[model samples]
Target chain A: MQKWADNRAWFLILPVFLVVAFSAIIPLMTVVNYSVQDILGPGMSVFVGSEWYKEVLHNPRLHDALFRQLTFSFCVLAIEIPLGVGVALTLPRKKGVWASTCLVLLALPLLIPWNVVGTIWVMFSRPDIGLAGVTLNEIFHFPYNYTADPLHSWLTVLVMDVWHWTPLIVLLGYAGLQAIPEAYYQAAKIDGASRFAVFRYIQLPKMRGVLLIALLLRFMDSFMIYTEPFVLTGGGPGNSTTFLSQFLTRLAVGQFDVGPAAAFSLIYFLIVLLFCFVFYTTIVNLGKGEAQ
Target chain B: MRMKKRTVALLCYLIFLLLPIYWLVNMSFKTTDEILSVFNLLPENFTWANYAMIFTDPSWYTGYINSMKYVALNTIISLTVALPAAYGFSRYNFLGDKHMFFWLLTNKMAPPAVFLLPFFNFYQTVGLFDTSIAVALAHCLFNVPLAVWILEGFMSGVPKEIDETAFIDGYSFPRFFTTIFIPLIRAGIGVTAFFCFMFSWVELLLARTLTAVNAKPIAATMTRTVSASGMDWGGLAAAGVLTMIPGAIVIWFVRNYMAKGFALGRV
Candidate 1:
């Protein structure tokens, strides 16, 4: 089994490493430099140590936005995970034109641009002319203006995210479901397992890996959501829809506050890394348990 | 018996999924007056003016073309780089291989917004600001990791015995890869390309920040339409519908590979 090999294969990976580093690492280093200093103008800076970090941590705006972000991500996970699983369970297992049709239809929403999804929802929720707003008011006689009402604004944003992203979860879940061997189901049937028992024991355990990936992907994407809320509500009826990403953008681009925004970004990056690490470890341990 | 219930549930899901898309298509076909007049599933009067405006105008169509150019370029560049890297990782162990793989995956996790300001400055200093190339390169930061991860999964699934067999048959590495390995993982490449296209196509914030006028993507063009002369609903709807075409075509082509792509990290 031991064979001497020419090491030329390393050449294959060089182009990718170079591209990723040029695009990602160099810019990241620049951010780290900015985070540590006060940039008054071009070529003028004063070292501030952790001053920017302290300021960002204590800022009430950051606090509020972080809270909103946490809540929004949690809500997205709560709703989309179960909804996706339910939809996956319902998909026909056999391959045919029916399967093809379902696949295409489910993927339609995902293909639309994020900003366009926001625009569509914004127009769709207009009280005067939009379909959703008009129908809800006409049927129930309840006034709904997402632009003017904070609750409606949040609700609209949540519904829009769900509409755009739930298909991703379903697609992932379906893939996992498809990979399960028919023998497992046959065994369950012979054992006289009930529908609930089959799902609880076989399907759920089999899906844990894909479900974890779905959860983490949705969590990160939802946490970093900016364009949808930006276009839809413009981050408010009084800042009700301002998530952390929008808040960071407003600081860095809107006010041109380079130092604090850089620090804020680092903190934001760390939080995401921490969550991903936790998710990765937990799933790996679960996988090990299953292997055992 | 169980099949009947599954069919009913799928029908409901399909309706829920397609309703908004239907609404968009419906609005795209209507006159502004008709759109404003009432809420109906079907337009009172249908017109092609929206589509005409997008097709005829340079400002409108340019955004579409610019987006397509960068998206296509990004997909090509990402795959070309990722194919080799993924192959190397799957087939050989080298200096810092494990660490390098982890580092690449970590890059994918970094938030794009975090790097926006720095990227602006970096691209400007390097004479790449406001160009399609800059946008395309910025996208590679994330897409390459995804492509590598996905391709590696597929590559691992291909048995090592094939490689040994090819080598014993006097096939060079490149020839074997081109003739044997590539065909085996064609589905994986399709999936990787689909993801690269989808993410780059829909991305707005970086695409907006990097380009000012010449290379403005359609996603950025939406912002301008809002600020210019009274929210041109017709123009915006037209642009929205047109922007959807590339993505729809991509999904149509790769519909089969999606199940494999979605199963990515799980496998």
Candidate 2:
């Protein structure tokens, strides 16, 4: 794992730098530019200088979207992490036909196009024709309509997300579980360790690295979720499922409120960056601790 | 008892995962009228009309071609750039290397929605709008970083001695990388390419925003089915089923490596 001290390696990274910067930096600069100016026309713009920031900071809509986004991400991480690990535990360890089949099926949802996932769920959960919807309404005698009911819409989006993405967690958890040495289990058995004790001591500790990656990946992706919910609920049942990304798109692309939307974009970027910083540092420290 | 419980749990979760997909396939076979009126578990009157429509229609089939174009471009660009960058990170500790690696990763966290306005304007200014390349470049914002991360994991798995030995055998850097280093990590490259293709293929917001009439992705094209004439449930279901085909095929080839690849090879 020892690496040579070679600054010339920067040359090797130059291509990636150019590509990512072309995609990320120039647009970011434009967002920053738009945030400061109020455009009257194509070239006729005034330097508004923090007016948009002030308005966006106090905006109630932004507040609501941020709150909703937080709750959604929290629920995603809470449900997915444990469920993924639990399902992963049930997977067959020895490689064979069943194990391979289980893996392929588990990975199918993760590969589906995001909007298709939304569309599939729309058909699968519709009250009129959807299996879940009809079962709830006719079979179980419960009122379930994602289109007309706010609570139903929210639940639909949440469950849809769980179905679409929980496989990622399961895959990561299964990989982590696979990496644990057989000696650890043998040692646990020799020590007369209970199943709970073995899992707590051996499996959990060993899986920390991958579980952390899963946590951060799930958190960031769920925080930025737009496509599925946008397709499914269209940010409705009267804005119940509208999250931060959809809100920003509405302001910027839908309404052309460039100044406020640009400021809001900056704020949104910073919030994600803040969380990334926390997770990044933790991962780095974990590596360092392991090295020592 | 424990084996029975485990099998039951796995079966339940797998069933939960497959049911929606089954619904999509089932609906694809029924007529739109049948989808609305009948609540049958299976297609009452199975037909190939929906699949036929997709294959016969220019608008429907071109979307798939366009999607494939951009996804291919994005995967090639991502892997080409990420290869050396990943090698650099895996092999050397340069100035700002750690910081640069983390910085590259931060791009993966930037929400695509935030980039919509700026990208729309920026691409239009450069006249790259409505092109598959535009979508490909925009997707690089996320895909490149991920490729670098995953490829780094795989590259680091190869020992430093290989590089040194290759050099001692009178090989130039490029020759060594392509002939010696590449074939050694070809599996890693395949996995990285799969991740790149998967991420770029599944994305909608940027792909939809970047293209218009000429190079529209199938995912974007599928949106047109929701016209005022009510939904084309059968056709839409067929298109949805089609979108999953490429992923399913690619995942099958890489089935053994799925977990390790998802872990970015770190595990």
Candidate 3:
């Protein structure tokens, strides 16, 4: 794609600039203002600079939720990525109706509303009524109650997330797989490459761009997961499933602690930025150090 | 042996995928009383009372209408703003192109939780609270960047010669874009619209925050379940099932573009 050096192209970007500015900048400035002020009430606020930030930084609950959030994100990335790549590999490779059938079926869960995903899981995992709960209790003879046991609650959230979102990775991975031309595979076959060898050398390398997209998207989405977990666990049987977003929501909405919430949010933003920076740098290093 | 193993893996995955969905359907069929009273694989007494309640009750069904209104508005606004920005970004090297692009992506990266409070206050002050336009504009914080990225990718794929030739033929910029450029990237537009629709439709937090009653989203409406009767479990399940329909239909319509789009501009 050739790009002309035209400073006047700035004119074309004006609408997007105005819209995003109105939506993002004002609210962000509001957050920053609240972060440094003690909003006593409507039209009454004290300038309490850095007070909220310090308190939020030291809060034990924040630490707990941060740990839980990180663990959940790590688990999601670990499970979804490889599984998505593998599922993409396994999808019956062809075109037309059969292929689209597979794609649509896999994508169904991804398209459903997050709240509905939560609600469906809630209905499906009810101890006395749910198929899962019933099977675990009756057939498997394992006592499973998401609302009572912390472990059960955590596992249920993880399982629900995997159920709802793994298909997104799969679809992305499948697209990446589809983009690989036939010539490469044919060449691999001619060289007597085994299935694993061909995948390792050809498919993995070719899928890097889409895989990176999948990784970054999955990281951000999973990190900020709110509606599903909020609906499913209500942030817990005991705050076990309460991630950073849930904690932030609790601070801002439930407690109305605007200053702390805002400061906490800034930290949350920084942490996300930090993780993205790390991921980007590592990927860059990998690109520089190795051909693949 | 290889064939057997492959078939087994695929079947296992499919079963894992569909089981919870099947359970939700099973729940939708049963009455709330039956669901609580019995532990059964299939609904012993099937009922459409839940669905009937939704259709009969305007308050319940209006949530769907309100949601569609805002989502449609958001998608249209997102595409309109993103179109020219995408063209500009794709075709021209501006003074701060990289910085501008980064800023857009950063907004997309910003969590909605951070914006909920400020948005609530801002919308209230602006008198846009509980209106479809407010929520639609709020959604642009994220959707605009995504729309631009998707459209830019597609636009870059189109040859620059088309733009040059159209200009040489004495066509104005707006005319060439509307008639020629847009049609060429129609798939990109469809894909972008589908995404904008999905994200807006599914997001409850910001939508819930921005609206109280008149513009309430279906997802938010579903959560307002503590009525005179306890939880209304059957009704909730039925509503959840209904909510899945629109998204399913949209994906089915755009399944082809989705396959192409996912590899490119998709998150």
Maximum-TM-score candidate: 2
C-alpha TM-score for every candidate:
0.96, 0.99, 0.96
Instruction: Report, to 2 decimal places, the DockQ of model 1.
Output: 0.66
Better of 2 and 3 by TM-score: 2
Off by over 4 Å in 1: A1-10, A283-292
C-alpha DockQ of every model: 0.66, 0.90, 0.71
Docking class of 3: medium
Task: Tell me which residue pairs clash in candidate 3.
Answer: none
Q: What does candidate 3 score on TM?
A: 0.96
Question: lDDT of model 2 at residue B15?
Answer: 95
Cα lDDT, model 1, residue A291: 60
Tens digit of per-residue lDDT, candidate 3, span B19-110: 98888888788899998888878888888898999999998999999999999999999999999999999899989997798789778788
Per residue, candidate 1 scores C-alpha lDDT tens digits across A1-292 of: 2222446766888999899999988998998999999988888999999999999999998999999999999999999999999999998888778887788888888888889998888778888778788888888899888999999999999999998999998899888888889999999999999999999998888788889988878888898999999989989999999998999999999999999999999999999888987886786588668767
Write one digit per residue (lDDT tens) for candidate 2, span B171-250.
99999999899998888899999999999999999999999999999998877675344479999999999999999999
B43 Cα displacement, candidate 3 (Å):
2.1
After superposing candidate 2, which stretches have Cα over 4 Å from the reference?
none
**Per-residue lDDT value at A226 in model 2:** 95
Instruction: Estimate how well candidate 3 is docked, as a DockQ score.
Output: 0.71
